[model samples]
Structure formats: C-alpha cells, structure tokens
Target: MFTPQGPTLRELAAQALSSVEHGYDLLAPKFDHTPFRTPDSVLDAVGGALRPMGPFESGLDLCCGTGAGMDVLAMLCDESVTGVDISAGMLAVGRERLRADGPPSGIGERGPSVAWVRGDARALPFGPAFDLVVSFGAFGHFLPRELPGLFAQVHSVLRPGGRFVFPITAPPRPSSPWYWALLGFDAVMRVRNALWRPPFVMYYRAFRLGDVQRELAWAGFAVELRALPEFGYRRDGSPRCRMVVATRGGGATPV
Candidate 1:
C-alpha cells in the first residue's frame, strides 16, 4: 500500500513496465512514502542488534536506496559510511535528503561521514575497505543464480572478519493469505516478463534460506543466524525473522 504522496496507479503501471533501474529511478522521489521502503521498526531492531557488535570503522550499505540503511551504519560505524546503489535517481534523492537534515549528531562532530556511490552489487568498486556491510530489503532484485557473484563481491569488499548482515523473514505457509498474495504477484511478474523486454528480476519466492546460506559459504563467509526476538517466533519455535550475519574469513582464498 502507498500513501497519498506515493506513486499514482498510472505511475505504478509505468514503473512496473520499465526495467528495474529505470523503474526505481522514476519511483525514487516517492519511495520513502511507499510500503516498499524498509520499515523503521526493522531498522531500529537491526540497529540494536548491531550496536553490541560495534564500534566498527568504515561501513557500507549495499544497494542502499535513499540511504535508509545508512542510518543503521552510522550508529555502528565510527569512521565513515558509504551507500552504493545502481540508480542515479535514488542516489540523488538520498544525497538531497542527507544534505537537508544531515546525519544524527550523536556520534560527535565527524558523525560518520556519508558518501553515495553509483555501482552494481555484483561488482563492487572498492577494495577490502569496509568493516561492516548492511543491506535492507534489496535481495529480490537478484535471481538465485546471481547470489554467488553478489555474495563474492560483498566478501571482496569487507575486511577480514567483517560481516555482511541482513534480516530475512521466514516464508509464509501455503495456507496463509500472504503466501497467495506473493504467489499472485510473482505470477503477474512472470507473465509481464514473458511478454516484455529488459525483464525486471524481482521474485518474492526466489531467495531460499538454505540456498542463500550455501552460496554465502561458497563465497567464503562463515554464516550464522541470530533470532530477532522482537519479531517473535513461529509455532514450531523457529524465529519469524532472523538476522543473517555472514562473516568473511581472514584467509586470502578466492571463493
């Protein structure tokens, strides 16, 4: 669901028809008003979970749309924070927002200096320059096959023992309404891509936890899952949402 300031039906239609980058570019102005943006509650929970792991140095927000994840990075990292995204329009909006309000003044005068770079996640431009990396709600854009390269890139950019952290929710059961809703959405996307050029690669059901963990292991990360107790657990005693913390090993081996 979108707010009054969010994209209109026609605008949504136009965006859905375009390529992911172009669609996000068109939607950037109103992205924060839409449900698509990561919620503040999840952000707060992640910040709380990561705070104990700090105080880190340089941090990176992978696929950082409008720099929402940067807020979490700012609280944890002391030196600096960088947000890398592929959409110039999204980066422009993020830059303007940060300039207008500025980062919170909590961590002293330097205040975790923020920088935005336009780049792809599959091929990060930086070296082993970051101590921590965080991404929020951006995984659907990459297909299952692309996980290896994506995780490898993240591994490449993080320093030894650095982490790539993100929250993942357990998929709803087949009997749940949310399951049917997501299935319908994916079906429509499949039909749209079948008939259209420059296919958009967002599919809700594509990113499986088992597959993801395996890929992260293949990419030289020691994977671990910590329960986010704030979201509570399922009837089977499994966590509804868990933060996946994949730590890069100190060894200089290629994944």
Candidate 2:
C-alpha cells in the first residue's frame, strides 16, 4: 500500500533484488510515502509512553531509517539525539530533511542537536553515551538468531540504567487474515533468500515478542513491557500493542 509518491513496482522489484542496505538506499527517498515507514501514530504513542520516564540527556535511534524515530527522541531527550543506519542513501535523505525542517519546536530555546551516522545495528559505533535508544519497524531485517548479538549491541551503547525502547504489536491470531498474510510473506522471503545472493532479509513473522524479551534479558537488560493504551486491548483482554522497555544495568556484558 503506497501513495502516488511512493516507489513504483519496477523500483520495488529492483530494490528486492539488491542487498538490504542497497535496497533501502534505493527506497529511501520515497520511503515516507510508503507503508514501510513507521506510522506517526505509533511514534506518538511511544513518545507518550516514554515521556514520564525521561528527561534523558542523550538518545540514539537504532536502524534509524530516514530518522523517524529521532522525533521521539527529540521530544524525550533534551540534550542530543543520534540516528544510525546502514544505508547511506537513507542517511542522506534524513540529513536533507533535518536541514529543511530544522530543530523540532517547543523544546525550550532549542531541541536536541541531531546527527545521522551510517552504521550497522549489530555493531553500533558508539560508547555508552546514550541514556535512551529507540528503534522502529527495523527489527524484521534482523534474523531470529541475531537477536542475542543485536540486543547486546543495544545494551552496550546505553548508559547504565539507560533504556532500549521500541513498540511491538501482539501477533495476529491464526484465524486472522493478517496472520496468513504475514506467514505467506515470510515464506516468500525465505524462498527468495535461498535462491538469491545478498539476501534482503525482511520477514514479518520472525520477530516474536517472547523471543525478543528472552534475548533482551540474556543481554543483561532488566526488561519490562508497558501496554500502549492508545491501541487498546484485544478480545482476550491483552494489550494489542505493547512497548518493550529494556534497561541496561551494571552487569551488562558486551559481546
């Protein structure tokens, strides 16, 4: 589902054939017009949930495609925010947007100074300089087996007591159309990766919340889940969307 300004079918096909980094580079300019961008509503909800817990001085947005998650960090963190991604094209677009939009308004005399760096999330290129870290719609690019190292990387970049936060939706029931759609998408991706080189790893069904929580804990995070009331609850009375707040403690050991 894309708007008229979004990438054409031909462009998308070309992107699919490229490596994940290159594919995102090709898609970066029109990304915000596509369904792939994290929705403003989701970002707002996460901001609201984190507001009470912060006044954080420094924040980082992991896998920050076009810097959407940085908006949330700017609202919560007063000092500075940094966005890191593997795509130089995405970072280029993000830099242009920042220059045009300027600093976000209403956060005192100035909002946080923002910077974009090209770096992989698996090995973030910074010290424990951040009090907060956030990611949006990027975890699907990481395989299930990479969860441990990924979480460890996030933990390593966070100051003690700092949080690695992100929103996750509850999986659809087996009977739901969405469930089948995601299942099919993952199956197709698996087949494509098997047949192709420089695999474009984007599997909708692979990033389960339970597995993620376990990995976060293993990475020495004191994990907590907070329900996003804006999304409401499911028929089973469980939250339809929840924010995972994994805090790095003193015991965190980098891999």
lDDT, candidate 1, 171-211, per-residue tens: 99998999999999999999999999889878998989999
Listed in order, each prediction's TM-score against the native is 0.97, 0.97
User: For every model in order, what is the number of clashing pairs?
Assistant: 0, 0
Model 2: per-residue Cα lDDT over 146-251, one tens digit each: 9999998888888899999999999999999999999998899899999999899999888998899889888999999999999999998999999999998987
Model 2: lDDT equals 0.91
Candidate 2 residue-pair clash tally: 0
